[model samples]
Target: MLGATLVSAFSLAGCGEEKAGAQLQGPPPAPVRAAVLERKDVPLRYEYVGQTEGSRSVEVRARVQGLLLKRTYREGAFVREGDVLFLIDPEKYRASSAQTGGELAALRAKLEQTRLEHNRISDLFAKGVVSAKERDDAFAAYDSAKANVAAAEAKMQSEQLDLGYTQVRAPISGITSQEVRSEGSLITTDSAGSLLTTITQLDPLYVNFAIPGTESMQVRRQAQEGKVVVPAEGYSVRLKLADGSVFEQAGRLTFEDRYVDPSTGSIRARAEISNVKAQVLPGEFVRVLLDGALMKDAIVIPERAVLFSQNGPMVYVIGEGDVAELRPVTLGQGVTGGLVVESGLEAGQRIVVDGIMKVRPGGAVSVIPEPEAGGEGKPVAAGKEQSAGNGGVN
Candidate 1:
């Protein structure tokens, strides 16, 4: 009993000594830069460089041969359909029109005379005062006169059409380019007349860009494999202009090229965007955002907050009592906002964004108050570093 009492007393003394030593060696809490984490919907966007084009383009051409007497529409101005653009010399056309009218009038008079003779001959035949051959001749002359009148009327209609053609009108409503043929410029029904001016329809503009076919095929494979989802609304697009500004209007994916280019292995795609202000001009290069589908329920963290240890990629998660817990995380891709945390982090958790060097696993930490909007916590996407090459063509 005496020996057992001594043994218990020694154990108590040993525990006290170890506890004192631990207190002496314990380190102070490390100060860390941290961010409050949130779980929310993030857009999975695909960006590409693309150029713009007018939705519809037409070139005005002269259809008839004439001296370009006068131009009616202002050069490089908006023109409406059926608006007169040019006027060829109408004097020659008017003279031809008058000649056709005179020819028709003369033919009508001859037809009237022939009809009278035919009627008179028929009456003579009924009275037995003329031969049958004489009556037949009068009837044939009347038919020939009727045919002559028809021919003359056709010629008169042709002349009127030619006169109308002298006034060249706009085929469609659009912004016209500079006039190529000016007044007194002889316009012929040849190549010179055919290359008049170009008009561009600009209410809705087309943005044309090409994605490598292999990348597109890879996206399809992912969708089929159920790795990523494509929205029911299909794909939508937005643009970044040359000035690094987001365009006011959004666009829709309109077409995909059926054939891939052998040289570049890219398939062209077009997006139609409303250019109501003419802000997006044709043939201008713009940043194209193709995939805008939401990635439901994602965890995003800053790149600095993520670190690598022997355990692979890890983040220092701040827990209760401001204790730092090193957690291994799987990342999606580095995005403009931040790196996506696929696993090992939850919403409402705090993680160190900066000053991680002073932190250690299971150590107490002091978190600096995060700044307000546009603060240091804002994530900058490492665009090129993103996995799958900026999320691939999807």
Candidate 2:
């Protein structure tokens, strides 16, 4: 009986120790990072890749046929309207003009002689001093001389225009390209390959881009319904270059195509921006950002907090006791660094911003201050914070 009691007491003590050990080994605290929910303004913007094009572009070509004698303007140099760009061999044209002028002068003298003879013949015919045939022959000669004079005058005018054409002048004020035909190269008026140079006006530039048909349709429908407010005077637009630098000057949306591209199923739009400094060039690829629409009370969350699941998009929300609760969400347009949640979740909910992978549903989470990015946490401005906060959940 004494041995039995001692064994039973020892077993009870072992059980108590095991139970204490098990109780001490509680569930580990969830490693998590979080972000505060604040209300702030979030400007809705759409990003699209576009290309820059000059507002005006023209190709310069030789108008008259001649030997290219001189290039007056330097290649790739800015030129003014009426600036001489090329000097074709004017000698041939000059000779032709001179010959025509001389002939015209000679014809003028002959015309004077014909007039005098006609006057004399009219007097003789009136006085009946000469035979009818003689008078008629004199009149015919005078008429022929008058016709010759008219022909010569017309020829002179034609030759003068041809001579003027030898000096190729710029039709518009813009930059000039390299000489396609070098000096002494023969060029013709009707040559199939007569491209001389190209000029593009680059002060104010145009940005051409396409928006997906669905997005465009939404914009159009909203605009028609008067539910969305587009800028009345000038809609603001921002540009992103191929190198990812944002352009300094803001642009305006000037045009939208009436038809959608059949192949791409996108609608084209154009924005005009002042590039007086020649910052934007033709054929440069860029991105255009249009900003105007405002959501009064929209909910937004940091993009990192949103997770893609087979079920749909979801985010982990910290509930009553810092417990993670996975909530499926519907997302709207994405803004910079975050997404606009159309549904699910609510305002004032703590979201795991960092260390998301370490937490699971119903898991305990410790709310710690997010480490300052870089050296210091960027101070959220008063109104801006509210705007940003509203972007997550109302």
Candidate 3:
């Protein structure tokens, strides 16, 4: 019986030692890194999908009805205002102009003869040599001749205008599109049918975009709360091409719609972009980033620290005694290094930047403070920004 008791005691001792070894290791308390939040100005920049458009799009059409004799400008060529684009057969217009000219000349000669007769009759009436009816008849004939001459001159002006229209000229300087009416085809002045070609002015292009009214209102609210500072002038814009490349030239905000769209609840906005090289084409889709407003005294944190849950965007912050605590934060948008915390965060707090998988709410953790980023954790002295607001490069 004594031997049996000793064997049972030995077994219990061995199991206790195994449990103690496991407790000693304990997975090293889940090593994780963190960043300290500092209050500094963050640029309240925004990005929206946009489209490029030419500053001016003009339709090149014949102003008068005529047979198109030849196309003067090549298709897809650059043209200047008043440059002849097509030559309508000028024969008919020229002949009509000549006819008017000849009629005007004949009327002018007749007018001269009537003036002489009227003057002679006046002289005869003064001397009492002609009857009153005879003097009246001369005066009436002279007036008739004058009226005929005036009518002929008006006809001549109309004919001259028609002659000028025979040569179809560009109404605006721009890049011309393909010819819609080829040579030898009859073109007309009818508004519905008079599309000969199109010319688009792309030198100063426009980038059109829309922002939902709710977003705009929130920006204004933040500015009112002393958290945002809007520039006196306006925002500067940049364009991102389809291939994820940025356009070389910069742009400025020039137009804003007066009211929000009732259907889409979006406010229309436009940016005037420099296209001196004609690199941007009309109707091209792009992404527009606008900068100028400053989000002041903001808390920014790394993205990995943020965890998405059904409740909303939340993060695990290192609290007192190095314990991880769950924090629900509202975020505006993303920035260069991380996201700006709209609410539910403060300065000088530690958050997990990497090894988030090691973190859990209400649990003790090993502290690993990460090196402060240039702008994310490091506080900027007054006017000592690495650069201006988000309006410039990061």
TM-score of 2: 0.73
CA shift at 390, candidate 3, in angstroms? 33
lDDT of 2 at 95: 93
Ranking by TM-score: 3, 2, 1
Model 2: how far is 83 from its true place, Å? Answer: 2.6
Residue 238's lDDT in candidate 3: 93
How displaced is residue 96 in candidate 2, in Å? 3.7
lDDT of 3 at 180: 92
Misplaced by over 4 Å in model 1 are 1-28, 32-41, 111-143, 303-337, 341-350, 354-364, 367-394
Specify the highest-lDDT model's number. Answer: 3
lDDT of 3 at 176: 91
lDDT score of residue 273 within candidate 2: 91
Instruction: List the pairs of residues colliding in candidate 1.
Output: 335-381, 336-381
How far residue 271's Cα lies from its native spot in candidate 3, in Å, is 2.9
The lDDT of each candidate is 0.80, 0.79, 0.83
- Name the top TM-score candidate: 3
Q: Which parts of model 3 have CA positions greater than 4 angstroms off?
A: 1-33, 309-312, 319-326, 358-394
Clashing pairs in 3: none
C-alpha RMSD for every candidate:
9.9, 6.6, 6.7
